[model samples]
Target chain A: MKEVRVFAPATVANVAVGFDILGFAINRPGDEIVARLNPDITGLKIVAITGTGDKILPTEVLENTAGVAAYTLLKHLGKEDLGIELEVHKKMPFGSGLGSSAASAAGAVVAVNELLGAPLSRESLLYFSVLGEEVADGSFHADNVAPSLVGGITLIRSNESLDIHHLPVPQNLQVAVVHPDIEILTRDARAVLSDTISLKKAIRQTGSLASFITALYTNDLPLLGRSLEDHIVEPQRKQLIKGFDDVKKAALECGALGCSISGAGPSVFALCDSGYLAQAAGQGMQEAFALHGVNSQLYVSPINQDGVVIL
Target chain B: MKEVRVFAPATVANVAVGFDILGFAINRPGDEIVARLNPDITGLKIVAITGTGDKILPTEVLENTAGVAAYTLLKHLGKEDLGIELEVHKKMPFGSGLGSSAASAAGAVVAVNELLGAPLSRESLLYFSVLGEEVADGSFHADNVAPSLVGGITLIRSNESLDIHHLPVPQNLQVAVVHPDIEILTRDARAVLSDTISLKKAIRQTGSLASFITALYTNDLPLLGRSLEDHIVEPQRKQLIKGFDDVKKAALECGALGCSISGAGPSVFALCDSGYLAQAAGQGMQEAFALHGVNSQLYVSPINQDGVVIL
Candidate 1:
């Protein structure tokens, strides 16, 4: 095929409980990437940047997540000589803490794979996706990238092997996402966090994360709710987001099982048991943000089992 | 119901990846407690202490684990005026990191429950069991008591509400426990650990723990093996056990999935997939301890699915 298009779903990184190690993909707002094989072009080129957050995205091939992802894949395959044109249509908002960069990176790799007649496996593509992410953010963490590429909830075992495990998504689970009209750079949010955590708090986080995974497999809502607590990271990072406490309280009051900042945040997410509660929680979160003079976007989605789709 | 006898199984607390939250019951070498309701006594009394290592256990009613557990349960049930005589038949070695005190505590409370018309529920029993542990160890932790009372693998949610959850035990899993002739008090082992850990290390611990729980439900042996790692506690506490590194190496080389200090120290347990491997691993662990001029006792048993039983 001369051309291919792919859509990489947005992912909720950290998921409140397991920071830097856990994330889950979600449908709705995601990034669409179009890759075209062009023999006339000498190297990978960023053809266009469109959609909701186009103004913020870089059209330069070296700087764009999509372009960087395409280049990384071709280089790894020893086909860097191949010419490719890439377009990133960002359906999700930029710096929204919804894994927008990951979606763009994952989408570009998937599209490039399809354009090149499919040589790399989905697991292999994760390496290039992470490399793409490194160009956008200065680290090689795959909590978001793995889920955006592989779908469902993921645990990044180690960055060395890029080992990723897909955890079971409980049935009837709903996700309430609210993005406030504010930008908190991932670097800035991360900078606010302390380098060290008390041993007692660390042990609690380990227990909570383990419990959260077990709850997913057993479909125990109460345990899941109990396990969604983060004593280490959220307490530090929550300060970066405006009205974070109010948004979280509103969501919890609206029947969210748990609430916390999604990824590194200006955005927040709540886990609800039912779709009705999810919608209500989302509205509650938005209203809470509005009370602080912060307008917000809301998305109530089922746990997205399938990640990137070729459309 | 005037006289009741119960056996609470030994538990492997910490379980490598989860420091203060995870534990599993084992079949053999537990505490056997006999509780008798004698109106003539008018207060709790510790009548006897016997078996492997009884010299260290307290004989006084207020100081003895079994006596304290009985007293706590009776006081909670508003039946403190009822006279109770408790006998602690310590089948498990004391100060061995095999939950010896927890077994005595859990067994005594269970026997007292039977003798007192069985009014207390299992969940309610955890509160008193923790209180029982406090008498022996000076802190409230239910990782051992919960599994010993409730059976199988258990997670203690909160000490306040005494909320506990039982996790599914893999059918093919075996536990290889080796107790070297060394005493490492829980308080001392815990004291060696630092108050804080780096955020980088904390995140790794969380991922490992989550992987461990997921492995149990999925029966993923390799994942379980990989997840049996402790960056926070084991590294600091392992020094308390003689030849700890050699013992762990022997167990791992003998095909055990993972190996670490059972609870606090002195005793080390290795997880195995087969009974044959469990036996081999147990022998290897014993030999490793023997090389350091330490006598050791070995127990190879399947993960005990049933905790305490009435006799």
Candidate 2:
């Protein structure tokens, strides 16, 4: 195909139980990118930028996540001179802790790969996608990008070497994400975190993370619920997101198996055993946020089994 | 049966990647206890203690781990008045960081259950076993006892509620343990740890642990090898065990997948992918310890699939 359009799903990163190690993709409200290859043209070109959430993104190729991702892949494949034009459409809200930057980066690489005859495997594409995240966020973290590219639940074993694994996703697992209207910059959310944590708290968090992964394989919902705890990062980062406490409490009370801030927040996510619980969780979180004088939007979804897809 | 004898296997706690949350049982050198139910007599009794390693144990029922465990079970069963005589046999070395105490506690419960016509399931028996551990160690930690009781590798989800799960063991997985003739109390190993850890290190440790559990489920040996790292506890506690660095280096050089201190240490263990690697790892560790002027004993074993067995 000479050109292809791809959609990279939004992801819930950090996953509460695992600060920077775990994340999973969701189906709806993602970024869209169109990749076109022109043999006569040279290098990557930003053909256009258009979407509901485009106001917060940079139009410059070097500064944009999608452009940076395409450039990175082109450079890696020794095709930087090969003409490629990417039109990015940001469908998800920006800076809402829903992996907006990751979806763009993932979509760019996927669409470009399809446009270039799909030489790279999804895992191989993850490396370039993480590089795009580096350009957008000023750090190398694959927690969001890996899941967005590979789909389902992903564990970032070693982000430096790009060693990532896709873990088993439990059947009937549903995700409820409530994004508050207020924008919380990732930098500010990160800045509030303490440099060190108590060893006792660290042990608890690690145990929770390990148990959470085990529960996924065993399909133990109650055990999975108990494992979704984050004493290390959540306590410090939750303060950056307004009404987080109330939203989380409301989510749990309304039948969410567990609830916590998604990524750096302004977005909070809850894992539920069924669609019924997921809807209740979403409604509860929205009502709680409204009570705190905050407006919010909720997205209820099943675990996205497929990440980036061509359309 | 009026009398029954049981053998409880030794355990490796923490398992390098999970401090106080993960452990696995191993075959060979274990504790043996014989329980005799005497309807005519009242309360629990210590009949006799025998074995090459019995010198370290206390004869008093209240102070002895086996006796304490038996007594705890009888009290919980509301059969405190029923006469029970426990004869302890210490097969494993004491204070060797091989979960010697946990073996005695586990053996006592198993023998008593058999003597009483098996009134409880293994899972139900775990609570009384943990209570026995509390008496022996002055703390509530099931890392050793749970695995030694349930067999295979076990994750202690919540020690308080006794929520535990046994993970699958790979077919060719082997374990090599080298016990240096040195003792380091669990309390001393724990005291050296810093009150707090750097958030960076905590993240790495948690990622390692999560990856380790995932590797076990997927039977990914290379991934498991990479995950057997302990930046939080090993650095501080390794100093307490002599020749630990040399032993670990020797094991790795001998083709073991990974090596780390076994439990609180003085004993070091290596996980091997095959029997040949296990034998080589054992020899390498023993020789390394000898080079450090410490006498050592070696035990090569499969990942024990059975916890306590009646003979």
Candidate 3:
């Protein structure tokens, strides 16, 4: 078996009101896993597992995200009969909004593709990684995986064609992440959102999304801050998180551009102009959480320019 | 007496499904009238009239659109003590759906401002024109005025703030315009549209708008054509136009990118890729109208790069 290399990064989903549509990668590197082709094995299998959720499960193709990614890739490539051994390094926490499962899954597919000299394009692998997320969330959503796989803030115009896409990363922007010491299931969080939204609300959402894109292009801070508001989702989800308002207020007081629930909640992210402000916002959020009788950690990082990479 | 030069251009409104949100300017120039400040006149008076309905109406300060713009600027600048003489011209017919009122209003404001050495920002002047549109339409709507003043695809973000915005134009675009000799009053058209739209219909409208924006970004010609559809306004408004479907069919068959009612339109605009296609589309639409017993003229012009202008 020859050595394979794979890398994955953390991602932020639901960038403001663009629910299920917008996402981006963060500067901090995520988990990496490597797998090598083992020609002698019989059926599709995960010979080994590491990095994340390893204690909760075994090296099975059905339950494991990385294993599922490899299986799906093999199935798509018509090479399902080939056996492979995967080794993952769990660098980020499982409960964080940093797309832990996606990291593992993307890492697996990337490693396998690299070992085979890269047959699929980056977009194809992104699709493959999203399949792995379905095993964890009971639904396939690319809000997190696409940005982590592609790097920078991505607008998913449509998943089918993957033709209308681009990265709108504003220069000199920083991301401050505050992950509370609590676990909220993504499925449970998603269930609380209303299936119907008012036309007025929807119009506001569309206008803001357009403005956010425009601001990124124009590099206007105040306009970008205005676009970070979500009248549809954030108000309902704020109750799930302890001291969310205080943290948001603190971040705003500390000169953070905007703050909102990351992905499904329990984790919060703030946009800032510099590393100093990001750090301050993160610390403020952590302190606010502490006041609410929960210990939390913060990560002040820049926008991830490079997404997935092989090491 | 000081001479004031005011310029207004034609605007295409309701741009596809961006109903009440999107508009753009046209290269085909409209009326350009000069309002000269008069030392001999008192309490707002007009001195000269040329081109377009000039002799048909009162040159009273409150009645004339160009005169109203001059009054608005004078009022804002606190130079109301000085009397201004307005030279009015009507280059385009009022009911052509090319936003003749907006052109006259914007032209009036620009001419006055330019004569005054540009005391107000360009966007502010745009708002001044929007204000003048209220005298004719009974409400302030930036849909027409912004594009006329801005010279590109302008999206009205907010009228209260007077924050009219511009979007990037797609490349290799052609605009084929057909004017059927039919009059649809703005009031009648506005009355026909349902006050409230179904949620499903609204989403479809938004999707159409989003797809159009994405197509513009991706330079997807076929997709751009597909995205020109509108489920909300077109169905209700098409009943007013003579042989609307036939015109659309002919335009599409003639290699037009797409066709839609142009601003409460008796006129229709078809998008295409080149001059030849635009000309073909124009002729086909005219032929369709002729077959339906309606005489129509065609303008095979590209997307207007210049908004309102002084001719």
Candidate 4:
């Protein structure tokens, strides 16, 4: 194929108890990437970009997330001179904590891999995708990138080793996400966190994470809801997102199994047992945000089983 | 039934990645408690205590773990006036970090419940048993008590709420436990730990724990081994256990899946895929301890399915 277009879904990272370690992909509000072999170009170049309003995204090949991801993958394949032109369509808001950068990077690498006749395995593409993500946040974590690439719920054991595992998702598990119009920069959200936490709180967090994983394997929705607690990060970062507490309360009251800040926030996500409940929770969350005079967009989706797909 | 004699298996708490929240039961070296109706005694009494070798265990009803557990159960049921006599046979060593006190407490509750025609559900007995455990170590953690009472692998989500869940054990999973002939009090071991830990290390620990739980559910033994890491507590407590580093090294060298200090210290445990490998690893751990002029006892067993049994 001379050209390939792929859609990469947005992702929710942290998942309350698994800070910097767990994330899951959602089916909507994703990025689309189109990669084509350009004989006229000597190397990779960003030709066109859309959907990101006036929010200037770098178009330079080396500076852009899509270009950098494609470049990294091509360099890894010893095909750095391969002529490629890319178009990035950002369907999600930037710095929205919905893994916007990860979707673009994942979509780009996936598209480029298909355009190059799939020289590397899907798993082998994660490293380049993560390196591309590092360009946006300056952090080496892959909680966002892995789930967007591998699909479903992803647990990253170690970012240095790129050791990632896909956790089982319950059949009835649905998600409701509310992205408030306010933007909370990941850097600003992260800067509010403490360098150290009490050992008592740390143990409590581990218990929650362990129970949360067990709940997924056993299909125990109530246990999953009870264990979806963030004792360490959420307390510090919630202040960055306006009306996070009220939004979370509204989601839970509307039948969300659990609700918490999605990634660094501004966007809040909830898990529910049914699609109907997810929709209700999303509407409730939106109303709660409105109460705080904050406009928000709501998306209800099932856990995306297939992360990135060809369009 | 007028009388009942029951056995409660010893447990390995923490399990490397889940300090203060996770544990599993083993088949051998457990405490046996015999509870019988006594017309002469007006309340709970510790009639006899054995196997502890000159260690003065509390015989007072409120002070002894077995006595306290039985008393607590009877009190909760409004049967505190009923006459009951108990015989405590301690099969495991004290301060061995093998959940010795937990076994006694669990055995007592199970035996007394059986003697009373099983008035309480098995799940409801965890709280009384945990109260018994608190007499031994001033802390309220239930990692050991829950597993010894309920069997298999247990994850205690919240000790405050008594919210516990049993995790699946792999079919071929085997345990090798080595207890060096030294006493490391839980209090002293806890004292050496810092009140706080770096947030970076806590996140890493959470990754290991989440991965470990996922490995158990999927029966990925290699992944389990890789994720059986203790970054928070082990580093601080290993110095209290003689030959801990060498013994862990020897166990890993002998094809054990994972090895770490069990519970607080003095007792080290290893997980292996086969019974034969477990035995070999146990021997290697003992030999390594011998190099440090430490005498040790080795027990190799499968994951105990029935935590406490009536005889």
How much does each candidate deviate at the interface, measured as C-alpha RMSD after superposition? 1.2, 0.9, 3.5, 0.5
User: DockQ score for model 1, please?
Assistant: 0.73
Instruction: Using DockQ as the measure, name the better of candidate 2 and candidate 4.
Output: 4
Model 1 segments more than 4 A misplaced: A52-60, B52-56
lDDT of 4 by residue, B1-311 (tens): 27899999999999999999999999988999999998877888899999999798989989998888889999998889899989999999999989999999999999999988899999999899999989988877789998999899999999999899988898799999999998898889889999999999988888889999999999999999999999989999999988889999999999999999889878999999999999999999999999999999999999998999999
| Model 1: residue A137 alpha-carbon error in angstroms | 1.0
Model 3 Cα lDDT, one tens digit per residue, A73-178 = 9889987876777776777777566688877887778888787778998778977788887786666667777777778887665544443355566777999988
DockQ, each predicted model: 0.73, 0.77, 0.25, 0.92
Best by lDDT: 4
Quote the true-contact fraction of every model. Answer: 0.73, 0.72, 0.05, 0.96
Q: Of the candidates numbered 2 and 3, which has the greater DockQ value? A: 2
TM-score of chain A of 3: 0.93
The alpha-carbon lDDT assigned to residue B11 of candidate 3 equals 69
In model 2 chain B, where is the ten-residue run with the lowest total lDDT?
B50-59
Per-residue accuracy of model 2 over A189-282 as CA lDDT, tens digit each: 8899999998777767777888899999999888899999988788888877778899999999998999998888889999999999999999
In the predicted model 4, the residue pairs found to clash are: none
Better candidate number, 3 or 4, judged by DockQ: 4
* Candidate 4 residue A303 C-alpha distance from true site, Å: 0.8
For candidate 3, report its TM-score: 0.87
TM-score, second chain, candidate 1: 0.96
lDDT of 2 by residue, B1-311 (tens): 38998999999999999888899999977989899978777888888888745365677888887777888888888987888888988888876788888988988998998888789999888877877777768888789999888799998877777778888897789999988999787788778889999988887887888889998999999999999998888899889888889889999999998999888887899999999999999999999999989998999999999999998
